[model samples]
Target: LAKTTQPISMDSYEGQEVNITCSHNNIATNDYITWYQQFPSQGPRFIIQGYKTKVTNEVASLFIPADRKSSTLSLPRVSLSDTAVYYCLVGDLNRDDKIIFGKGTRLHILP
Candidate 1:
């Protein structure tokens, strides 16, 4: 599995957008970059994923560099309820993986 590093925290005002980036310089060929969002008590939920190029869903957009060494997750027009922890993981999604969550990027939204 490829190792990933992410920022510890970020602050944003309500109605503004947020973008969080992760680094994985040693990413493997079979690895895929995945992003998950977590609230205070809920388990992390998949936000978006990609092997290359850009992928967007109703919630967020994931942009991956050509070399796959880094990825950025963009949250559009965030509100106070959007405050949460964001995590990045690099590995095969179909495999029995035990991903260790980092302290993660704590997104704080102010009204």
Candidate 2:
């Protein structure tokens, strides 16, 4: 698994768009980028994933650059209830790889 670099914290008001970027400069060809969100005292939940280009789900959109070294998770119209920690991870999911959770970016959504 490749270590990811992300902002420590971010803030946005309700109804604003929030984009969190993660850098995986040493990502391998088989690596995939995944994002997760966790609320206080709750387990983390999967948000989105992508190998290259864009991937969108019901909750968010993931955009990976052609270089496959970085990705951005886009959250639209975030509300106060959307406040949580967001994690960006990279690894070869095809293999028996263990996904390690790190200190993710804390997103604060203001009213």
Candidate 3:
């Protein structure tokens, strides 16, 4: 299964679009890729998820390759409030599992 990798940090001005990509080379068959956003001192909140192809919601768009080795989270018309840390979690839902957190990609939005 592919492990996940993401940028340590990113910066954007208000009203700009931000796209964060995560690479997972050995993702398992039963694993699902989920994206989350977090502010300082807070837990990550679910942003989006996908098994394959593309999935979009009011908050963001997720694009996954056919091989499922990587995924991207695209935030459009970003505002200062969008500045935060973004995380890509890869794991299976079945069985009792523990989710771990790493230093996520920090998105800084300039006012």
Task: Give the alpha-carbon lDDT of every model.
Answer: 0.88, 0.90, 0.88
Residue 54 lDDT in candidate 1? 97
Estimate, for each residue in 48-86, the C-alpha lDDT of model 3 and write its tens digit: 999999999999999999999999999999999998999
| Strongest candidate by lDDT | 2
Q: Note the residue pairs that clash in candidate 1.
A: none
- TM-score per candidate, in order? 0.92, 0.94, 0.92
Which one wins by TM-score: 1 or 3? 3
lDDT of 3 at 43: 77
Q: Cα lDDT for residue 81, model 3?
A: 94
The residue-by-residue lDDT of candidate 2 on 1-111, one tens digit each, is 688899999999999999999989988888888899999899989899899999988889999989988899999999999899999998886787887666899999988
Model 2 misplaced regions, further than 4 Å: none
lDDT of 1 by residue, 19-103 (tens): 8999999887878888998998998998998889999999999999899999999999999888999999888756766655666
Q: Pick the candidate with the highest TM-score.
A: 2
Give candidates' CA RMSD values in order.
Answer: 1.4, 1.1, 1.4
Residue pairs in clash, model 3: 1-26, 2-25, 2-26, 2-27
Native-structure RMSD, model 3: 1.4
